[model samples]
Target: MLLFSRNLDKLFFRTLEKQLALTYATSTEPQREEEFRVLNLKHVKGQVAPRRPLKKIVPPPPRTQQMAENQDWGNVWPGPRSFHPATVPLPVRQGYVEKGVSPGKFGNAELMKIPNFLHLTPPVIKRQCEALKKFCTPWPKSLDSEEKCERHFPVEVSSSDYCHSSPTIRDPLARIVSVKVKLEALKLDARARDKFLRLVGDRYDEESDTVTIVADRCPLKKQNYDYAMYLITAVYHESWNVEPWEELKSEADMEYYIWENNASKVNVEKIFGKEAKDIPQIEVYSSAVDKYMNEGESDHTVEQYGQAVRKILNLPSLGA
Candidate 1:
C-alpha cells in the first residue's frame, strides 16, 4: 500500500510538472502564472473526475563518445574574423581591446631611458641624483669603465668657454687679407669673367670704369682643404639637400674655381668692356682681405641677374 501511494504521488507530481512546463513555454507572463499557482490553487474543484496522468517519457542519456565527437566549439571561438559583434564570445571579443602600456602604467619599474650626460647649461646635479636614486639598477660593469654594455649609457665630461664679440653688423665690413695675381688670370676670357662675376658679381659702372666682386674665405690652412671641403659640403647638404647637381653645378663649380684662385685679379675687358677696369671693387670679407668695405657700385638680385647673365651668354639684353 505504501509503495502504491508513493507511485501515485510520483505520477501526480510528474503530470503537474509537464503541465507547468507547457504553460511556462507558452506564457509571455510566466512570473504572474507562478504567483497565481502559489496563491489561487489551494481549493480543489468540484466534479473532480479521476484524472489519468500522462506517462513520463525521458530520452536515453546521450552516449559520451558520440557527444564528444559531435560537440561544437564555434561558441568558444570568436566567430570568423568578420563575425557580427552580437555573436562573438566574451573572451574572444575582449582579447582585441588594447589598454595603453605607457610610462606611468608601470609603477616602481624603471620606465624611462635616462641620458648619460646632462645637456643643459648650468647642469642640474640634484635632479640627476634624484633620478639615480629612483631608477638606477645594478649593472655588471662599473660606471668608471669605458666599456659599454648593450644597455650601457656612458657619461663624459666636456668643457666649453663662451666668448662674446661685437654685435655682427653686415655693414659690408670685409678687410683685404692678401692679394695675389691669379696665375690663371691670363686665361680669364669673357666666359671665365662671366663665371667669376656670377660667383662674385658685376658691380661695375661702365661710365666710371669701377669693378667690384665678392668672395668668401676661411682661416683654414692649405692642409685642411679636405676639411674645408667637408664644411662646404655640409653647407651644400643643408642648403640644397634636394636640388640636383645638374641645376646648381654649372654655376657652383665656376664659383668654387674662383674660391680656389683666392685673392687673384682677373681681366674682364672683353666681358665688361674697356670701362671694366674702373668699376668699383666689392671684396667679400675673408681672412685674406685687407679691410672690410661697406660701399660698392650696385648689388644684383635675381631680377638684376639678367644683364649679368647676358654678359655670360653673349646675348643682347632685352632692354637694349
Candidate 2:
C-alpha cells in the first residue's frame, strides 16, 4: 500500500509542474514580444531623426548704395548720434594709413566714435522752422526800431547757453545773470544820483551812465535773473528815498561845494546888505565862485571870479 501511495504522489506532482510551466511560458512569450517591439520602434526613431540644414550667411547691402540723391535728410538723421559713414550717404573717410589713403566708409572706428551734426542741415533747419512758424508770433509794430524798443524796455537781461555731452546739463556760468539799465531811465535827481552812485559803488559807469548788476548766488539761471531784477528795483527805490537825518547834514557833509552855503555868501550879504537879491550881478559872482570851487581853480575860472568880485565891489578894472 505504501509503494502505491508513493507512485500516485509522484504522478500528481509531475502533472502540476507541467501545467505551471505551460502557463508561465504562454504569459511571458507575449510580454517579451511587446518589449522587443517597443525597443525596435525606439531604435528606428533614433536612426530616422531629420537632419537640420546649415544656415548660409548673407551680408546686408551698403546704405550709401541704397540711398537716393533726392532722399529727405530729415528722415535720414532725425537727431544727434554717433557718426555712421554708411547712413550718412557721403564719401566720408577717417583714420591714418600709409601712402595709399585713409580708411574708407567700410569700417571707420574714428567716425563712428565721434559726434555728428548731420541732422541740422540747412534743409532740415528750414523745414523745422516752417513747421514751428505757426507757433511763433510776428514782431510788434510799435517796437519797429531799436530806440523805441529800448525806450519801452530799458532793462537788458543777459545770460549764456552751453551745450556738451556731460552727465549734467547745467553749466556753472549759465547761472550768472547780468542786468543793465540806463541811469537816465530812472529819471533820478542830483540827490538820488549821488545816493545811487554811492550805493552801487563801482558798478556805476560815469561816462555811459549805466548801472550793471550781476547776480550768481542762486543755483538756477532764472533765480539769479530774478535776484538781479530785485536788486535793481531795490536800488532804484532806495535811491529815491530821503531820511530825516539827511536834512540835518551841514555844508561840510555836502558832496560838492555849493556857493549858497559858503562863507563868501555871508560876506557878500554883509557888504550888499538886505538888497543882495536885488543886485543883478550878485548871481553872476555866485556862479563864478561855485565854478571855481567845484570845477577846480583854472585860469579862466580865476579870471572870471576876479572880474565878478571887482564888479561887485565897484572897483575899476586895470584894462579900463
Tell me the whole-model lDDT of each prediction, alpha carbons only. 0.38, 0.86
When summed lDDT is taken over every stretch of 10 residues in candidate 1, the lowest stretch is: 285-294
Model 1, span 231-296: residue lDDT tens: 433432343333355356553354233422333234343444544335333222121121211122
Please estimate how well model 2 matches the true structure, expressed as its whole-model Cα lDDT.
0.86
Model 1, 61: alpha-carbon shift in Å?
65
lDDT of 2 by residue, 1-320 (tens): 99999999999999999999999989888454443434456466558667899899897887888988899888988998778766877788888987878888767787776557789999999999999999999989999898898888888888998765566879898899999998888999988988988999999888977889999999999999899988888988999899999989988889888777778878878877865687768988988998898889899999999999888778987689
Deviation in Å, model 2, residue 157 alpha carbon? 1.3
| lDDT score, candidate 2, position 174 | 87
